[model samples]
Target: MGERAYNFGAGPAMMPDAVIERVAREWQDFRGEGYSAMELGHRSEHFADILARAKADLRALLDVPESHHILFLHGGATPHFAMVPLNLAQPGESADYIHTGYWSDKAMAEASALVNVRIAASAADSEFDRVPDRAGWQLDPAAAYVHICSNETIGGVEYDGDPDTGNVPLVADMSSNILSRPIDVARYGLIYAGAQKNIGPAGLAIVIVRDDLLERVRAGVPSVMKYARHVEWDSMYNTPAAFAIWVAGLVFEHVRKAGGVTEMARISVEKAQKIYAAIDASSLYINRIQPASRSRMNVPFFLREPRLEQRFLDGARRRGLLNLKGHRATGGMRASLYNAMPLAGAQALADYMTEFERKNG
Candidate 1:
């Protein structure tokens, strides 16, 4: 196999080389079945086993309580933006959302169309560089659920810890940082993540809904959008994303074998630190987000001289540093240091930044 560049693209992002190799090895003949994994039958026993193993590995790894059901939804985390309000709250009922960054704002924007979305707390006043302090949150006790994006992929801001939303169901869109650390599943009312970030491939979202919330589905909600129905159908409400789920299963197993989330967290912190250190130490580079709120997964920084942005990116590409461009919504440079990125990848990025700064600063 020839060398592969480190993929820092946010979604459809870098996957563990081992998982990619395993997929390649099995793509044509899944376990000697002689059928391509893409051709896998969702209802077949083979897929059942694959799904069960993925769920089990994820459950065991995260210690998801018996009170929750893990769902492998077809759309990436987006559909849940609408499905969540529809399933969790009655039409026109209010739900509290903490506006943190681009994705969180998107969630609020989507939910506002379906429900009375209340901004319990927001950092927009600060330009979305950090999470609104939890102390200032004015939560609605009667709201259906309190939603937060544990890690904002675009703005590169992340929560330092699980928030205490007393008595309210805390729902989080952990799309960018789900498996990067261990979470107390019991603390959340529901947790959903699109697979493009820390999990497997894109187009799949994981939903861990507390069992009791199943009965609360507002009447008239479509069967497909209803959580209870999906739970009863065992994530088979519609034709599942078989290939993505299968690949996700392999990724889950790979994560488990690599010492699970604790180890992933350890490595993630170090990798992020390596890159952030480079930015903080340089005068020409800048990360405006507060230190405590900086993300451990996506690190976005800007060059002091915007004119050199393209030149820096071009140089980075020539060095095999791919996808360092920031989200189009926020113009700058972003390096998504997901679990698949090796320590060497982070070091290489830091080294390149240093060399670039020394030459251009």
Candidate 2:
């Protein structure tokens, strides 16, 4: 604890200490080999084995079915905003998008360029402080697919559970909360996540897509963007992000050892409750989001007395609580307690909040 600080950045965030230590030890000569993981060719036998082990671990952890294909892709989830439409939505056909937060808005914007777009549901009227009820979604009967951002990082809203979108295939961007809880992979036609929050480092994204979706690719979609091509070539259609995928695999193993997603979900709820209770009890701070729709992964709050914002951040930093500042657009303090953040860290932050209120109130 001497040098380590509680990190709360939204993405490219904290990683498990066990993973970091192991990487440091074996980075130079992985598995008794002479070359570092970064220097090895993507096609080398050693790297191939590393990737296979990773995918195997992931498939086991998430309970992914044999009917689904897993791919380690290059671009972040940002690119899939456009790629999803290009592959699934033909020019005349429309796609349904749920506008839950900033990310969903961006996803719809990208989709609009390629196909007819329909906003099936939106929380814009609420300023994204809460998730709209599932019953309120305005679904289209003839859309190509239904897309939703499973968790909205910037707006501090998350779906408590998956939604049933009728016979329409559901596509989800679960970037911030992928392994934070258990998910039924069979329910989704496609699940994509940028591996920086609960998974691993940046430069890698994990996509679990159903086998039927492969044949539906609209012609002329970029080869690099097509899910079919990646599945056909085993995500080796081009040079993969070797090191990032390796780290993701290691993270998958770590989650499995910790008792898989069900256990992770239990811990996630406990961690969130610890901090949320402190926020609610304190007269000096307020979290605007609805408790039921609140995000367990990212908690955004504001001091009752705005003048103490700087003091609160500075004092927390001195105490080794770091990166608790909110998103600039939102203008408040956000504590992003991802999977790597221990319950002890949340309790520590809660203690610091009590102390700060005592002094400043």
Best-performing candidate as measured by TM-score: 1
Model 2, range 1-361, lDDT digits (tens) per residue? 3577888788889898889888887789877788786786888897788889988998988889999999999878898998888877778899988888888988998888898889888888988877778888889978899999999998888998888887888999999999988888888989999998988878789999999988878887779989999999999999999888888888988989988988889988998898899899999999988888899999889998889999999999998889989998888899988999988888999899989999998
How many clashes in each structure? 0, 0
Task: For candidate 1, write residues 1-361 as lDDT tens digits.
Answer: 6679987788789999899999999889988999998899998899999999999999998999999999999879999898889888888789999999889889999999889999999999998889888999999999999999999998999998889988889999999999999999999999999999889888999999999988878888889888899899999989999999999998899999999999999999999999999999999999999888999999999999999999999999988899999999889999999999999999999999999999999
Residue 176: error of model 1 in Å? Answer: 0.5
With a 3 Å backbone cut-off (N, CA, C), the pairs that clash in candidate 2 are none
Least accurate 10 contiguous residues by lDDT in model 2: 1-10
Which one wins on lDDT?
A: 1
CA RMSD for every model? 0.9, 1.3
Which regions of candidate 2 fall more than 4 Å away from where they truly are? none
The candidate 1 region of ten consecutive residues with least summed lDDT is 1-10
The per-residue C-alpha lDDT of model 1 at residue 39 equals 94
